[model samples]
Target: MLQRVRLAVFLFVLGGFLPSVQADEVWEFVDADGVVHIGNAAPPASRGLVWLSQTPSARGGSGSAKGKEREVSALRLPGYEAAKPHLEAAALSQSLEPALVIAVAAAESAFNVEAVSRKGALGLMQVMPATAERYGVAGRILPDGKHAAMEPKVNAQIGSRYLADLLRMFDGDKELALAAYNAGEGAVLRYGRRIPPYPETQQYVDRVMRFYRALIR
Candidate 1:
């Protein structure tokens, strides 16, 4: 009951800041005492934290499912358990929070190793073949003739590396980095490093942010 109350309060506070005039960053930290702390920025020397940033316009998006049901659905997603260790290892390699990587997987492909988007994004993180090639992760040509990014380990590694590169490119702004992930880094750069006004990109960032928050919470 107490946890629920706190989450409600957090949501209320979150909604309150969604209309701020400037891009806003929300930081979350859990101290050794296990209490969750949330603020616009992390205090000096903080540890065990995760955060997401976005322009106000990205709030209340619909690129993915909403509510507690989304979290429950993620846990029940096919291939979730199978992909967990790989996601963890990949995140560690990139010095990212495991929850963030897993959230991207959940938002992208629902942990479906066989999932492929119409745009040709593949595997757990929906990594494009071109993106995977940059990391030397060549998908196998399956017997059914699908270009299959079938290896969970390789796919996760490539996705994490790409996400890490975007994070660096966007100066650690998770929202803009995510926007790059969906709409291409070139598009983000064209938009002056802000979350592009594209609805799809905005919603994708919002969706991933929701999942990351739920996982960390």
Candidate 2:
């Protein structure tokens, strides 16, 4: 029966659903070539699979199922669990929600502490050097003598503070704040203090909001 259930889950994830099986759980594994696979069941051990996260069912009394799903999704990032302490501390210090910090980090760089964007954004939060300076994260260096933005804790702290400031600037409108974070406060204000119509910024806000809602509970 256990074997059958596992097969059902695998098939459901690969293609269709099994009425007897719920797809509430999520898992991830990396292949030899660094390809990541996300699904509902653990892959074969011979495939060098690593378990990522498991979401709870939403059918319970409270409607926390969605939040569990988002939490699992955020946790699936490679370094998220390792960086949770930093995220929590930063968020608490800035009066921001930890989940929001995690979600932004997830959306920004998939938890890659060394990530650098084409436009020169750096670290887990993709903070540019200028933004880091503005947030008082400048002049800090990692153990390797790299910019502090390349460090997870420093990046999270600066990013959380920036996000908190944006929230206050936008009158606590999370969507607008996120937009300003992606595009720029000038762009948001240019559009009459609304989310800029720029497709990239709009999509960014939506993605962050999805992650935020899923994790916030």
lDDT of 2: 0.66
For residues 109-200, write the lDDT of model 1, one tens digit per residue: 65767766656677778788888778875766768776655578888998999999999998999998888888889989998999889766
Model 2 reaches what TM-score against the true structure? 0.68
The 0-to-1 C-alpha lDDT of every candidate, in the order given, reads 0.66, 0.66
* Residue pairs of candidate 2 with colliding backbone atoms: none
Per-residue CA lDDT of model 2 for 64-127, tens digit only, reads 5644554555556667788788888999999998888887876666666776665667777778
Distance from true location, Cα of 25 in model 2, Å: 15
What is the lDDT, from 0 to 100, of the residue 74 in candidate 2? Answer: 55
TM-score computed on alpha carbons, candidate 1: 0.65
